[model samples]
Target chain A: MKNFVWLLAVSVSLSGCQHPSLAYITNQGDSTVSVIDAAQQTVTHTITVGKAPVGVAVSKELQRIYISNVEGQSISVIDSQTLAVTETLSIQGSPVGVALSPNSQTLYVADWYSDRILAIDTSNTKIQREVIVDKAPAGLVVSPDNKTLYVAARDSNQIVAIDTQSLTIQKRIDVGVHPFGVSLSADGKHLYSVNVYDNSISMIDLKDVEAKTHSIKVGEHPYCAMPNSDNTKLYVSNTQDDTVSVIDLNTRKLISTIKVGMTPEGLDYDARNHQVLVANWGTNDVSVIDARTDKVISTIKTGNQSRAFGQFVMQ
Target chain B: MKKLLTIIALAALSFNAAAHGPSPQKVEKTIVIKAAPAKVWAVVKDFGNMHAWHPAIASTKLEKKGDETFRTLTLKDGGTIYEKLRTADDADMKLRYEIVDGVAPVADYNAFMQVTAGPGAGESTVTWVGRFYRTYKLNPPIPAGQDDETAVKFVTGVYDSGLANMKKVIENSK
Candidate 1:
């Protein structure tokens, strides 16, 4: 009948690509997330989230996406399968950066103004605990084994390591000026911090504690750094330069700079496609980079001010 | 004294002017000029010469410290604004800059001025896109002249006035 045909058309348009690769771009200006189908290179779904969503964390097992809404002061949890917001959990303070444990049991929300990280239990949806950090904690990353959580205390100019079990500070390593984003390798042997003010990246070796951190200069106002699958290369999004600085992890040297859209804020490496998805904040689009050639393959249109600050690609 | 405290607060605001909050507002304005892309880019490429086309900027002072480029703009209405040049890409016909601090009720302002070939023949399009946050950083009881509306209005006004003057200045010239 005519009614059945209309219903079928609506479902097809509403559903996303079933492929494992998709980019959730957090548009703070519009309070929405544009889910880009990486394989098709198009925005398939635009889910409404809380106001001023800045960060994202994806859970592969649970098929969920968590977004930190700074102005809304809450977390918007989206079910990946359905591509819909399942819940909006309120936080006591403003939430900026969000990350999930390797096991997806704990979700860490960084409070930008309050200078603290609150750990929320995903199972029962309880405030499990919290840890106080220094001024302006901007980025969060958990180890592969979920034993350590690293905090980029941006205002303090240092990276603090907290024990995941006890939620206590274990080590505080000083880095260059204004370290905003931190990335850990898959093997958990190396860590990298993006220094927004210094325009460089600090490479820290966890294998050798005595190994002094090496600073590699990058482009202007680099915000996020993401590593490849094998941990051989690192790609950093220079917000002002509209380019990505690709650094060879072995030599600690800048290999090449890949030009992207305006104000590229977040970098996510898609393993299945062997591509890097960059969220362009100024242009409201996502630039797809072919990792092998280091060239922009395609640009998918997103919502206004796309700022997927954390891990946006579903695990 | 209250005066000293106000000065201290202003200094602190300028120092952290590049640090943004979760809520950043953006304004984008574009105008079709009766000129070529090359002619428009030339005026925009001169990072220190903003007063040439902008009617509100009375004069501009250029300075260099170390390897960086900086400029000071004296506004006609009042107050001065300081800016740092991020890049001047001639190949792309683009110029980028950020406001360190200024009279505007904005913080962490970054902008790009791009000149592109037109939607029509023999016409150039100039777009000014700016991203900035309100001067107030903390959770607000919302002070006067420091909210999102004030910051957006100031930038929108600047872009509108400047683009209109730029079209007139470029079209009238040889």
Candidate 2:
């Protein structure tokens, strides 16, 4: 009787530890979002989204995921628990990049064609405001304090910072040519932009906004960058080279280039699993790399043209 | 003169319709040959002898600068393409290359070619796949011959003809 009770206790503990975290990947070719269970490393569900879904963001507080569909000109709000798209919000321009506020109350989307950033109220699913920026705004990230938002204007080759409360442009910092993705450090002390045409990364020191930009050369046509939780390392995905360039934040130099799937575009760091999930557009799969070792440990196949451009993993 | 003008207008309209965005397009072509995987890989991995297998390639010149290797291929139609070798893995029987400068109606072209074992014994399959975007990497008012359709058609024609001719040559050699 005691052995049976102990066995029951073990089973309950195992079940409690198995709570799954999901990585939402947006497949552009087939218009679907693949929900991957990070613990099990398998695709748990495939939810149909709008046409050409490119960007994805998750709200942990609300238990929801927002996907921006470029061709459909809408955003698909997915319920994280149900694994279904609960609402589809139609916006005006071509929506590509997406981000959520710190409190998960407001969602920011970058419209590429219209050159504007649309702020949507998450509660009502309506456009709260629009801030017009430079041409071809692509990637966006919200500050940790929820005060500043950085926008990567691809055509203008500059990073624009906006005041979240005032809904106005705060600063326009010049970067490399054709910057596509922008990321902030954990402490919000640094900003990095992946320059597509220049094949480099512009590292902007937030404290010294007026100083000259520091450019770190990388592989060809880098698309996006994601810093680790500790801000010690930065991983940038080079699309044309099919490799991930790992940069050491202390030295600000490329430490290694790990080969991954073809046309690797979007990248996100899974803090719970200590792995970086890379969306390979050409190969239609997600390459998960072991962050500790900086090696590709496994490749999970997804729908065609997997491009999860924004914050996708929900811990 | 009226009929010619009408044809030109239709062509322009078709080009405009296909220039949707700067989305990456893919082209894949596969062919089976009556040869072993090793034999097929020998031909595919030879970075300098593409003219021997591909009928469209008139000549190939290989050059080495620093630690990088490059090949300049002269097409039969008088067009030239410059490519750089990225990776060649003998164990995987796979090679990857990228077009540095080319006459094709595509930009940022990268390709992978692999040789694998076929269903039957002494048979092999060669697959060539490429991902690229149209030369006009921006939205609309796209110039002629640089639209998405033109890039797709040009790449597809290149892969199809090359793979078909490769099958013929390998089978004939055996």
Candidate 3:
């Protein structure tokens, strides 16, 4: 009786809502988003999206995922419970990056070709606001506090910060050549910007009146950088070298580099599972690495030219 | 009645030939850069340094017939592009040339690049244009099953990326 009870408990935990979440990878070339089961270390589902999906974001409170299709100029919203596209939001120009509010009610999309930021109300699937920013904006992230939004300007080589409430540009900081991905620390104290051409990640102190900028070297053509849940480690995707360089934030040094697939792009660290999910653009696979050991535990084939991946909790 | 029917058949064959000419033999992509007219004139006039700005040509060898024209073999696509520099314009900053012989994908292609002063007095507008036709056919050795349109599309993608890269360099500098 005890043995049966123990098995029941384990199976219940595995299917629990608090169970380690799945990561959705957007494959640009294949027009599909792959869902990776963190516990199994394998792909459980591949959902079809619009053509050339580039960026992905997930909502913890709403239990939903958003994918931005660059060529289709739309966002496909997937419900976590059903794992189906619940809605599609059409926006102007080529939507490249997407971010969801902490409350999961709002989504911010960056239009790369149009140089604009679109605010979408998730519940209604309607455009709330259209904010214009620097030229060729790509990467996007909403603050933990849901106060400020950060965007990477690809052609302008700068990072634009906007106040979410006012929907106004608060500041613009100069970065390296072709800044692609931008992320803010969990506490919203530091802003990290990845410059693709310069192959470096710039760390900016946002708390101080005079922002102090520091840079750490990474692999060739560094494309994206994201912080761990604890904000202690940063996983950076090196597109040309096809590796993920793990950086120790406290020591400000590269501790290790894990080989992934051909030309890796987007990356996110799953806090619950302690696994780093990497999107390999060239080989069309998603690699999950054990965050504790910095080693690849498994690789799940996604699709050709997989670009971005994200994870969130189900409310 | 027989004579009239024969005349109609001849007319139909002529119309068919006019509508569908022989499939284009090959397709190719070429680039041209604009330098200061007088200064760029002499440099581009020589076939020796063709690799400097042109994307595909790795190198070049010149067999000069005179000061105005030269027979050149461009090291592009495994040393297959051969063209004759027919005219070099000093005032207009233009290069007009013809594909004399080559293994480029598109056949019967003529291209040119003309650099003219922009709206602003100091700046210049470089216009690059090419006209070519493509045909889909099988290789003789392969028993005529291969389609050539796929090859044309592949070359087009390469040229598109190359042009984007070239424009980035040129516009960023100016």
Candidate 4:
């Protein structure tokens, strides 16, 4: 009877530790990452990272998180299980944006100052190669097929697609002025670039590369974009306006603008809860919006200068 | 040869210093007026009549479009500024707006004005705050008028003068 009671107590404790999902937010000012449990809507751990961590990417299959520290000029790798920084890979130039391959075996770091992209082997965390591209690469996205990589070259005002195998530039499509964030539809048929200076989004049809791009006007100083699971809607964070502009993919027009916290920069779509998580830089909090209603449901406080640029939610 | 080398070194250092990217900045100013909080709120919340209280604003024109209110302010120097009213809450005595287009040497400008009861009876405190980035968004060698310092100075001057004049107008009236 005593053994059975101890066993039951252990099982109950272990079950409580299991979290359905986690959202990792990079706090630029504090140089730390706040890990929030989606189920509980609370920050479970705050892991110390390098200086000015702005970009974040997670590999659910591998259970690892990659953070780009722009000022520190390095990438801090965290094991999702341990919720700790396992290693830091130093790269020259200012590393601002990051993405991982579909297989979670390779990592891509965009160096804004160096004007190039560095590919690292994820297993060993070693610099595999570097591909030189346009000026000031700020955002990155991998194709669903995992064959191409799209980069938002801010200064050059273009999106450059690279062949992953060859690690060479495949296509250069002209976009709006100072495009900073890039995203793709769930089917990978359309590509979107958030243009900061023009306060617009450039929608590129991937099926026909030469097709004229459609520019949709959004709020001021838009930083990043995230598409829904079904590609029916797109959400963008306008930093200066402090609002999220909802775009209907069918009409390709602005449907609504939801007010958020100050300096909303990075955003991601959570498939499980069907919510959008936005990192507010000035307010030091995360605003969770209900995708169905397009309204802010809750605001969870994080560290200072939160900018979780890339895909931060662990599926 | 030595003089030429010194000039080259100085130019390189300045260029390097100017190449840093623009960072967001804030400017805030507060004034204590003898008027009551309700009186101060009335003047501040009138989004269309900024020229009446602000010394620098020469004229103001208000327009409404698609459920949004916009105001155009002509400054004393003949420069004009276009702003959109984001929110106005009477209960909180707070008004928020953003610059749509302007000649203020700043980009992505958002401002807030609030009026509250002061330490003394019948006295009110008014505060004006603005957050903005430099007009030049791209990586610098920023131009003379579009640098971070220029943006900060322009916003500071606007807030300082506007609040000072607002206090004078509110206190002197009635």
Best by TM-score: 1
Q: For model 1, how does the per-residue alpha-carbon lDDT over A177-259 read when each residue is reduced to its tens digit?
A: 88888989988878899998899999999766557689999999899999999988999999878899999999889999998
User: What lDDT tens digits, residue by residue, belong to model 1 across residues B1-174?
Assistant: 233223223433443633456577889999999898898899988988999998778799998989899999987655688999888889989988889876667788899999999978889999999988887777545677677877787788788888999999999999
Query: How accurately is candidate 2 docked according to DockQ?
Result: 0.14
Clash number for each model: 0, 0, 5, 0
Q: Candidate 3's residue-wise lDDT over A180-297, tens digit each?
A: 8888887888988999778899988887625578889998778788888898899999875679999999989999998998667888877778888888876778888899899998
Ranking by TM-score: 1, 2, 4, 3
lDDT of 4 by residue, A1-315 (tens): 999999999997776455467899999878999999775778989999998898898997788999999767789999998988899998777788999988988899998777899989998876478999998888999998899999999888999999999999999999999889999998889999999989999999988867758999999889999999999999999987789999999899999999999889999998888999999987889999999999998999999879999999986
Clashing pairs in 2: none
For model 1, the superposed segments whose C-alpha errors exceed 4 Å read A1-19, B1-19
Q: Determine which window of 10 residues in candidate 4 chain A has minimal summed lDDT.
A: A12-21
Alpha-carbon TM-score of each model against the true structure: 0.90, 0.80, 0.65, 0.74
**Model 4, span B53-119: residue lDDT tens:** 8877789999999999999998766667789998888998999898887566667678889898987
For model 4, which pairs clash?
none
**What ordering of candidates by DockQ runs from best to worst?**
1, 2, 4, 3
- Give the DockQ (C-alpha) for candidate 3: 0.03
- Positional deviation of A118 in candidate 2, in angstroms? 1.9
Residue range B1-174, candidate 3, lDDT tens digits: 232222222221111111111122223344444433344344444445555545655567766665645455443435445666646667666665655555444343444455554435444445444433332221122221122343345345434544445544554554
Off by over 4 Å in 3: A1-18, A209-211, A309-315, B1-152, B155-174
